[model samples]
Target: MIPFSLLDYVALFWYITFWLCFSWVVDHSRLKHHNLSHLMNGHRLRWMRNMSTRDLRMVDTAIISGLQNGTAFFASTSLLAIGGGFAMLNSTERAIQLFSDLSIPVETTRALWEVKVLFLILIYVYAFFKFGWAYRLFNYSSILIGALPYAKTADEQELEIAIRQAAEFNSLAGKHFNLGLRSFFFSLALFGWFVHPGLLIVTTTFVGLVLIRRQYFSRSQTLSMHLLPEKE
Candidate 1:
């Protein structure tokens, strides 16, 4: 096993720290202005309200099915990525030689390379679990949607309560799906680690900036805000 240098350890620690900090800021921070997530949440509430007014909610069911199918696709992709990582681990020597032949200057030993591959596998495994759970939550949300009382038969209060429950479940499933996608984004950054720690830092910063921009300042966020009330 090749021993990691102090810098290598620092790079790994920095990577983890930044990931955790970014996730917390995105999910928990209350900024002065609304982000995409906040706007989407407003839309979710509006969707449920609309659902309560309609006698038929086939469209809503279709949307929920789309979400479930998307989550399942991502989960399957994550599993495939894990399998690819394992395949890489099996051909560690060939991989190392290929890097050497490419004049890529990979300074790590075979053991370190294997460990990095394992780390990648771990990331995908975590993503798979997140996506899998998100898919299940979407299924639950669909069930809740089906359980909602019909507009023609139920009182206003009962309809409101049911809609609210279904909306909350859908929102939660969306949250987990976003988390899984975030992991996939970070995995792209992690690719730089195989080349150099400095490259990893640069790529991580780039990914973080891209995510923040899309979350808070993208055109999609603007459109979502337009869907909300002026007071919001």
Candidate 2:
């Protein structure tokens, strides 16, 4: 078995640290208001509120249907990825043999390759559960949407509570879906571990930076900001 090195441990730790910190900052920190998720969440709240005012809500239901379809797609993709990971484990010996013949220096130890494959499987498992739960949340949100009374007949306070519930469920579903996508991004970084621990660090950092940029500084964020009527 190829023994794990101290640098490998450090790289894994850094990957976890960055993922956790980035998630917290994006979801809970004061700076979150500046993130695209926060902006989109406001949109969600508005959508639920506006939905209450409408008697013909086919459009709103259609939007929820779209969201559910997207979440189900991701959930299915995560399952496929997990199956692929297990297949990789089954082929580790052949994979190591194939890599050893390559000119580039590659770590070709069976145990090390197995460990990497197992970690990849675990990441996919995490993502699958996240997506699964997100799909359920979206389902619940749709039910809540149907429960929403026409604004013309609803008591103001009761309608406010119902709208909030629908919006919160929708937002929560989106949050979990984003997290599953984050796992997908980090799983790409996990690919670097197949070559070298140092490369793992480099790839993880690149993924983290890309996520930050897209959330906080990308042109998409600018477009999202334009959708909001006022600053959060």
Candidate 3:
């Protein structure tokens, strides 16, 4: 049995609550439309709508390829992080020794260390699955793009439907990719757990705030929401 105290439970509970609430605020809140992710979603819709007017689609295919490549990189990184976690589990004594002299909030134990490392591995695994699914969705979007009819030959209604379908698939892929990256950021906060439960709570709160700011108040968000003049 792992030796965990009341403080550990409280810290873990807060960590989970912060993560869930942050996810909701970014992806489902009433003001989510003002965020960077929502802005990019609109850009994706416009990109697909414009694709319908072009005779050649090489530009569209290249952009999809880039999305797939980015997703694949993150998936591979998750696997590597998982392997590192297992390696730490095998060297549990060394990790405990390294922290033995530090003035930490809690004493280190083999069982507790193992649990922390396992949680880290679990997070990366979740990210890997998300990236994998996002990659496949990008592939589906590419196929949908290929299926779009030429604007000159297709009926107006059919072209509109095809454009909407392609845009939706692309947007869904972006959402999953964002989720995978979110896991990676939170996993960094987990390091504070190896030191102290109180520190863990503080670190998680800080990371959550940073993510929220980037999504809603960063320069990128401001720039993404900007539009060019329609005419001179």
Candidate 4:
């Protein structure tokens, strides 16, 4: 029989997983049936009929690339947090002590365990909100991409203006998604901090490495450049 303490950790782990999965479903559902022209330009097919094939293809690729890579990154981080939390639960008291020593109030010491639980709850909530918002912003970015004019347009001036608009809009949406992912690290660092300061630092470093690897080495992120330009 599993111990009740272990069960508690299991429950918390599942709770976090539930939210992450829920966000994934929501994200994928939004991505699956996208209407490129209407979404990008907020105009019907008639309005976008003037765009060149090359311009239309660029818009379609951007939407598909962003969703695929964003989903993979979200899944990876959620899994890491779940695994790390489980490991920390094995030494609950020590973890609590480490957290309390850092900055948590003494009056809350008796209720440290509860505080930790609350912190976990907050982390999950924050993560979901950020991820969900990013998904929406990416969707908006796709629409903006479609709104850009094709290179063959007679009006070179109009094409330049459209390109700038698309770039700015895509950049805005990309920032939100990237910032959302960074916010996850804040909670990750805190949870691990209470477990062991050294481990906390190590985990933090690993988190950075994982992000770098995903952005640079992961095939999914490589593909995402089709939607949002790769960062320097």
List the candidates' TM-scores in order.
Answer: 0.94, 0.96, 0.94, 0.47
User: What's the residue-level lDDT of 186 in candidate 1?
Assistant: 94
- lDDT per residue, candidate 4, 1-232, as tens digits? 3223443465445534544543343234454122221133222222233343364475565554766478457746665665555555556677556756776343223344545645665565566566666666666656765666666753878765665565555544544555566557545645553343444445555665565455445665444434532232
Q: For each candidate in turn, give its C-alpha RMSD to the true structure in angstroms.
A: 1.8, 1.5, 2.5, 13.5
How accurate locally, in lDDT, is each candidate?
Answer: 0.86, 0.92, 0.91, 0.51
**Model 4 lDDT, full chain set:** 0.51
The number of the candidate with the highest lDDT is 2
Candidate 3 residue pairs in clash (backbone atoms < 3 Å): none
**Predicted candidate 1 versus true structure: per-residue lDDT over 140-182, tens digit per residue:** 9989988888777899898878978988888888889988999
Which ten contiguous residues of candidate 4 have the minimum total lDDT? 32-41
Candidate 2 residue lDDT tens string, 1-232 = 4578898898889988988999999999999998998889988988988899999999999999999999899999999999999999999889998889989898757888888899999999999999999999999999999999899998999999999899999999999999999999999998998988899999999999999999999998999888886633
TM-score of 3: 0.94
Which consecutive 10 residues in model 1 have the weakest lDDT in total?
30-39
Residue pairs clashing, model 1: none
Model 2, position 32, has a per-residue lDDT of: 96
Off by over 4 Å in 3: 101-106, 228-232
The lDDT, on a scale of 0 to 1, for candidate 1 is: 0.86
Best by TM-score: 2
Q: In candidate 3, residue 25 scores what lDDT?
A: 82
